[model samples]
Target: MLIKQIIIRKKAQEIEKKSPYILLFHCSGLTSRQWRQLKNILCTFQGRTLFQPSCRGKLPYKKKQGGFIAQFAFSAGPTCILYLIRKTPDNTWSQLLPSAFYKQNLVLLYGQLQSTLVNHMDIKRAVDLETVSVFQQLFELIFYPYNSLCFCLNQPIQAE
Candidate 1:
């Protein structure tokens, strides 16, 4: 019985190691299909598998089932940026910067915000002076191209 348990564990480990998780995020108002062209490029690469989410903004697989290994985006070139949104003590939403920088090849930028009223979906219809101002600030901080991708974890970041 002990030997069988050990063998089962080993098989699970092997399955986990077989594929690296890659998260693809498209800019606001765009669908995950924004990465369709890039997916074609990555599919040709060796040892890479593509998993499309059943619904937009929803991850296809659970994290414990081998969480994402890397995040990829196409800008001027292949770039990876980590964006974080955190609730502040002032009872407002704001962006947080990563403590450590990413690799030179990876191209990660960091920025912070004091507060914002709009969440993800509402950014489009943010007509209020304050909401529109916050939206402008976000775009200025991270000028995500129409077809670009972003990386975020934990709570879902809005994308069509």
Candidate 2:
């Protein structure tokens, strides 16, 4: 798996203590740089770490044959989340779920994973399929109605 690491300094230790690390694994045909740029623009919260792993269908491996699989790793304090993103022959993206749907299941996973941390805390979290407008789609994809304290966004790409 090709991995790109991004580290952001926390403004306050209190924020870091409350924040949960987020891992956003995007689909194929997009470079880690693109994801990083989007993250920098959309993510305003502090004391968080981001990881973008370049899957097999992307750069340095796009030209190569066979299927591409990649994983994104996020670490915050003692908590960590892992999201997987893959590539399709047509270059589209999707989440890896039994039903292969985008909306409900993604949100279910997000809520299920971070329920304890987000119970009393107002932290926003979400996941969805990326649309045409990269920036707008990114924002829409992560607009969660839960907490406002910390935000955890996860995007997984499926080659279909």
User: For every model shown, what is its TM-score relative to the native structure?
Assistant: 0.22, 0.21
lDDT of each: 0.29, 0.28
Predicted candidate 2 versus true structure: per-residue lDDT over 1-160, tens digit per residue:
1121122222222223432222333222334444344355234444333323333444444344412321221211212222222222322233322222322222222222322322221122222222111222233333322221133333332233
Model 1 residue 112 lDDT? 14
> Which residue pairs come into collision in candidate 2?
88-159, 94-158, 122-147, 122-148, 122-149, 123-147, 123-148
Alpha carbon lDDT at 20, candidate 1 = 24
CA lDDT of 151 in candidate 1? 30
Q: Which residue runs does candidate 1 get wrong by more than 4 Å?
A: 1-19, 29-36, 56-160
C-alpha lDDT of candidate 2 relative to the true structure? 0.28
The sequence of per-residue lDDT tens digits that candidate 1 reaches over residues 1-160 is 3454344334323333432222223233332343433343344444444442222464534354323322222123323323212213331123122221111111211121223322232211212212010112233334553223223212232322
